[model samples]
Structure formats: structure tokens, C-alpha cells
Target: MFGDTIAAISTAWGNSGIAIVRLSGPDAWAIAQRQVRLQTGAPLKPRFARNAVLLDEAGEVIDHILVLPFRAPHSYTGEDLVELHCHGGSLAAQRCLELLISGGARMALPGEYTRRAFENGRLDLSQAEAVGALIQARSNEALRAANRTLDGELTRAVGEIYEELTALGAEIEVGLDFPEEDVPYIADESLADRLEVVRQSLADLLERCSSGVILREGIRVAIVGRPNAGKSSLLNALLKESRAIVTAIPGTTRDVIEAVLTYRGIPLRLVDTAGITENYHDEVEAIGVERARAAMKEADVCVWVIDGSEPLHQEDVDRVHELADTPHLVVLNKADLPQQISEASLTALIPASTVISVSAAEGLRLDELKESLVGLVSGTGALDTGLNASSRQVEELRGAIASVGTGLKALGDGLDQALVSGCVGDARRSLSRILGGDRDEDLLHEIFGRFCIGK
Candidate 1:
């Protein structure tokens, strides 16, 4: 596949100031030379941009453009590469790409360029994966985490553990080779201590992976309460938009409304569900109530809104008891009005839940509420912690952890060197998979398949 030249429009298809169309492989220069006429009528120089006029197969000028060339072994994908900068618009780029394809360049597939870069040793699997993550990042925290991975933070961490395992495996091999040697290859206590250290490192990585998954996937927070308890108002206040209907009449919102907002750089899917009431005026209202309960069940955290201006109703009290085991926040809304419901009384119902007072109508203490929500979802105030892991990466790390645990147990139980070494090999392989040393074609296809065509 590397023998054939490939081309693609590397920019988004839209009217913009400029669009970039890229080509890479041995024939990249030859194919581009046929389509572009240089102003100086000179051969294209490596790493230099030159004035050019793009021509169609009919030899007519399509557009005056700029051409950049990169030499082999130093460029992205470690191949001869060319990029054409043309006037923004889908028509110009599309025409230029067609001309390049006609000149012996095949259209590149989704993530094909990045995959070529990986196959050519320009980037490791983890860093290549980060390229997609960085592009898809929804928040600054996620962007920074992906950047950290791209910078080889994850690779270095995994490499350290892998090296230790390799060393342990070598020592076991030496013991097996020289049976008559009086000095032990690796003392049982020493082996156990080393395994413990590696296991601790894996544990720390897993902890970071947990945070990364949350930052990547985000959390679902459902705002649920009885009718007229200001549930829609709170949702509007959090999202800074009137995403849900609010009215004096009960059951105005007879369905669920959802929107996404960022809190402390962590995405929060805020869902405003219909008011939960025991008695419904119609079947639709009852269905809405059921949907509200379903949203609450699916939520990572529940923001239980309560009418602070009214005394606690039996319905609200019963709902609180129902959400006793859930991670929740008791939000006493309408605090701008007289406080008829005491915080002490609310706490008495759900002792483990955090309670906050906010007037959603006035936007009072909304920032504080946001901070509390961030804390509830992620125990830390900052989302970027210098590491990030995708779901697949985390699973592999967990496998490494499990394998290390097995090795530690074998060492602790005074098992033979063969058994312990086998466990070490398993752990090493697991870590290797995370580092992209393991050649799993299905896994690579799945990871790279998420990228856009031009990447």
C-alpha cells in the first residue's frame, strides 16, 4: 500500500479562506508536477512553497495556487509529500483532487495518511490515536489530555513498566540456563518487591485512565423534581438558554429536554425531565413521569430540585427516599423567595446528599452550583492531569494489572520460576498491546476508523 501514491483534500469542505489538498508517496511529486505549473518553471524544491497555477487535464488554468513539497524520511508519513493550497470552496479543491487522481494518485481513505505515518515510524499507535482525540476534543481539558498523550507521556510510562518486566524475564531465563550456579538469579523477596512496584505503577495509570474516560465520555446529569419546582428554570440557568418550557400550569413539560454544557472543562449532558407526580391528568403525563424516572436511573448524578418557597410536600419527601442510594444533590430552588423549607429538614431526608440553595430564576449562586456539580462528577477541580486513555487503552492496562497481580501472587506463594516467568510474560504482552507493539489488525482498524477522511 505504501508503494502507491495517495491524495486527499486535507481541509473541511466549505467556503473558507484557503483549502489544502495533500498527496503522499513516491509518485506524489510526479503526479503534482503534472497538475501544477510553477511560476518560475523550475523543479519543486523540498520544504518550500512556490507560486503555481493548477491545471485541469484540458491544460486550462483552474486556479493560481501555492504548492509545498516535503522530502522523504523527514516529512509526515516519511514519504515524498506535496500539498496544494488553493482558494477556499469545494469546487476548486474537488477539481484539483480529481486532476491529481487522474495523474496517478489514488484517493486516500479515512485516516489513511495518519496510518501511513504510523506504519512508517513517524508516530506510535498511541500518538496516532491522539491525533484523532485532539481533533474530536470538545473542551480544553480534553485537548490538553490528548496533547499529553501525543507528546509521549503515555508511551514513556508504559515503556518503563515494559522494561522492568523484560529485565525480570531475562533474569528468570539466566536461572534456567545455569542450574548449577550458587547465586540465585533473582531472590524471591526481590522479585516480589519489583513486581509490587510495577503493580503500583499500573494502578496509578489506571486511576488516571478513570479520569480520562470521564473527561472523554462526559457525565449525564438529570434535573428532576415535582411540577412547579423550577426544574426547567434550573436547566435554563445551567445551559444559559431556555431549552425547556416553563409555565405556571403544571405538566407543561410533558417530556424530557436535554442539552450539553461544559463545567470546568468537563462536558455535562444536562437532562430536564418532566415533573414527577403520583397522579397524572392523562396517559401522556404518566408516560412523561415514567421517562423522568428512567432518566434519573441512567444519570451519573441527579440534581433533585425542590421548591424552597413551599413547605416539603409528601410527594417530594417520597421522591427523596426513592433516590436515597443515588449520588445526588438536593437543590433548593426559588431561594429568592421566602425560605419555607429548611436545609436541616432536607438533610434529614437524604443525609448523604449535598444540599445547595439557588434561585434559578435570578441566576443566584449558579456558579457555585456549577462548581459543586464539577466536584460531584470529578472529585478534582481540574480535568487535565497530564494523562489520558481511551476505553480500549484502559482495558489493556487493566489486563496488564491483572497479569501483574497474578505474577505477584505466584511469587508470594513461592511458585516455581517457570510459573512466575509465565505471568511476567503475560503482563509484558498486555502492556505491549497498549504501546502498539502488539499487531492486532482489528483493533487498529477500529481505532483509526473513527477519524475523518482527510486526517
Candidate 2:
């Protein structure tokens, strides 16, 4: 499938100024030349853009375009590549792609371009995955994280430890094979120390994996409270827009109203759930209340808004009690009004959770609340060393850490040298797999499957 020249509309299809039709593989230039002719009738130059006239099979004009050619071994897929800069709309690019396909270029599969780049030694597995992350990033932080990985920051870090493990494994193998030879075996203490260092490195990467995943996939925050508790007001205040319907009447928002915003470069999906109350106005209110509960359970953090101006209700205390095991915050809203419920009292009820007083109507002390929300994501403070790790990478790191630990234990216990050598080999293989050393066809398909076509 990779041997066949592949073509795809790389740019978005719309009535814009320009769209890109991309082709890559051995016959990419030939396929594009068959569909387009340079205005000056000169041969296309490598790494240079030339004005071209796109023509149909009958030699009739299709569209005026700019053709950019790239020679093999320097292109994205390390193959001959061509890009047609055509007028942005459905018709022109579609016709150009059809012509290229008819000229022996097959339509590219989803993520096939990036997959080829990975297979052709242009990019490692992690970097290739980052290309997909870059496209799907929801916030600046996510984009930066993806950019770091794509820039080979992750590959460099993993490569350092992988090389170290490889050297250590070699030394251990020599010791095991030449036990009776004059070559001195590495002292058990020295081996333990070296293994400890590698284990620590893997553990640090493992620690950062949670926040890295959150950076790629943003957090979901649910705003939950009883009726007339300024739940919708808090959502609107955080969003800086009246996204949810706000009114003096209770239960104005009868369903979940969600909005996404960037808070300190973090993508936050805020869900304003309907007021939780058993005293329903109708079946709709009951359904809304149920959905609010579901949202609370699914959220990364739940902001339990309490009206500070009003005395505490049974529902408030009951909800607070239920959040004992969940990660939540106590937000006492209506701070602009004369206070009736003290922060001290709310703190006493939920001592583990942070209590912040804010007027969602007046937008008071919300920054502190936002900071608390950001805190819910673990290991976000460390981003300098390529914090982002895909689920597969995370699992591999864990396995490597475990293997290192097992090797250290074997050395300490004075067990067979073969066991220690086997553990070291296992750890090295795990790290290698992360850098795309052992090719697993099924794993490749699953990872690239998430990407959209033409990437």
C-alpha cells in the first residue's frame, strides 16, 4: 500500500483563498505532472514553486495552481512529494485530486502520510503521534506540549536513558558470559547504583505522565449546586459571557450548558449543570437533576456552589457529605451580598476541600477559584522535560521502571546473574519499543487510527 503514490487534500475544504492537494511516493512527481503543466512549459524544479495550469484528461483547463515539488529523501515521507496550491473551494481541489488519482495516485488513508514518515525513518513513534496531537490541541498549553514532543524533545530524553540501559546491559552480559575470565565483573554495589539512577529517571517520567495526558486531553469541570445557588452565574462569570440563561427564577437552566475556555493556558470544559433538587417543577427538572449528578460523577473536579447570603439548606449539607471521597471545591457564591454563611462553617463541613468566596454575579475572587481548578490536574508544574506521554508510552515507561526495580532486587539478593541480565534486557526492550524500535503492526494501526485523513 505504501509503494503506491498517495494523494490527499491536505488543506481544509472551503470557499477560502487557497487549498493544498498533497501527493507523496515514488511516482508523486509523475502523477502531478500528468495533471498539471507549468505555465512556461519548463520542467518542475525541486524545492521550488512554479505557476501551473491544471488540465483534465481531455487537455481542457481545470484550475490555475501553484505547484511545489520536493525531491526524494528530503520530503516529509522521504519520498517524492508535490503540493498543488489551488483555489480554496470544494470544486477545484476535488477535481485536481480526482485527476491525480486517475493518473495512478491513490487516495491517501487517514494518517497514512505521517505513518509513512514514521516507517521511512523521518520521525519516531512519539514524534509521529505528536503530529496528531498538534492538530487536535484545544489550547495553547496543549499545542506547546505537542510542539515539544514533535521537536524531538521526547526522543532525546528517552534516547539518553535507552543508551545508558544498553551500555549497562552489555556490561552485565559480559560479566555473565565471562564469569571465569580475567575481565573483572562489575561490583554488585556499582550495578545497584546504576540501576537506581535509571529507575529514578523512569519514575520521574512516569510521574509526569498524568499531567501530560491532561495537557493533551483537557479537563472537565462540573459546576453543581441546588436551585437558585448561582450555578449558572458562576459558569457565565468564568466564561465572561452569558452562555447559560440567568434569571431570578430558580431552575432557569433546566439542562447542562457547557462551554470551553482557556484558563492560564489550560483548556477547561466547564459544565453548568441543572440545579440539584428533589422538589421538581416537572419531569424535565427531575431529568435535569439526574444529569447534573451524572456530570458531577464524570467530572475531574466538582465546584459545589453555595449561596453565602442564605442560610445552609439540608441539600447543601447532604451534597457536601457525599463529596467526601470526590475531588471538589467549596465555592460560596453571592459574596457581594451580606453574608450569612461563614467560610469557617463551610470549611468545617468539608475540611479537605478548598473554600473560596466569590460573587459570580460580580466576578469576585474567581482567579483563586481558577487556580484551584488548575491544581486538580497532577504534575502540571513540570513541563520542561517533554512531559507529554501517550497511554502506550506511559505503560512502557511503567514496565521499564518495573523491570529496573526487578533487576535491582535481583542484584541485591545475590540471585543468578542471568535473572539480572534478563531484567536489564526487558527494561531496554521496553524503552526501545517506545522509540519505535520493535515494530508492532497492530500498535501502529491503533495509534495512527486516531488521526484524520491527509495528515
Q: In candidate 2, what are the lDDT values of residues 1-455, reduced to their tens digit?
A: 36789999998768889989999999999888888879996788899999988999899998999999999789998889999999989899999999999999899989999999998899999899889988987767778878888898778878999989888888878887788664437778888999999999888777666566777766799999989899999999998998998998999988999899877666788999999988998999999999999999999989999999999887898888899788888899999999999999888877877889999988899999988887866534564333567878989999999999999888888887678888988998998888899989999999888888888
| Candidate 1: tens digits of C-alpha lDDT, residues 1-455 | 48999999999999999999999999999989989899996888999999999998789999999999999888888899999999999999999999999899999999988999888988888889888888888888888888988899889989998999999999987887786665558887898888899999988877776677677777889999999899998999888888888897878889999899977677889999989988889999999999999999999999989999998888777777778788788899999999998878888776777888899999999998887876776774246674667878888889988988988888788777788889889989988888689898998888888889878
Model 1, global lDDT = 0.87
Q: Can you give the lDDT of residue 426 in candidate 2? A: 94
* Candidate 1: regions farther than 4 A off: 172-184, 313-326, 409-422
Error at 396, model 1, angstroms: 2.2
List the lowest-lDDT window of 10 residues for candidate 1. 379-388
**Residues forming the 10-long window of minimal summed lDDT in candidate 2:** 378-387
TM-score of every model? Answer: 0.91, 0.89
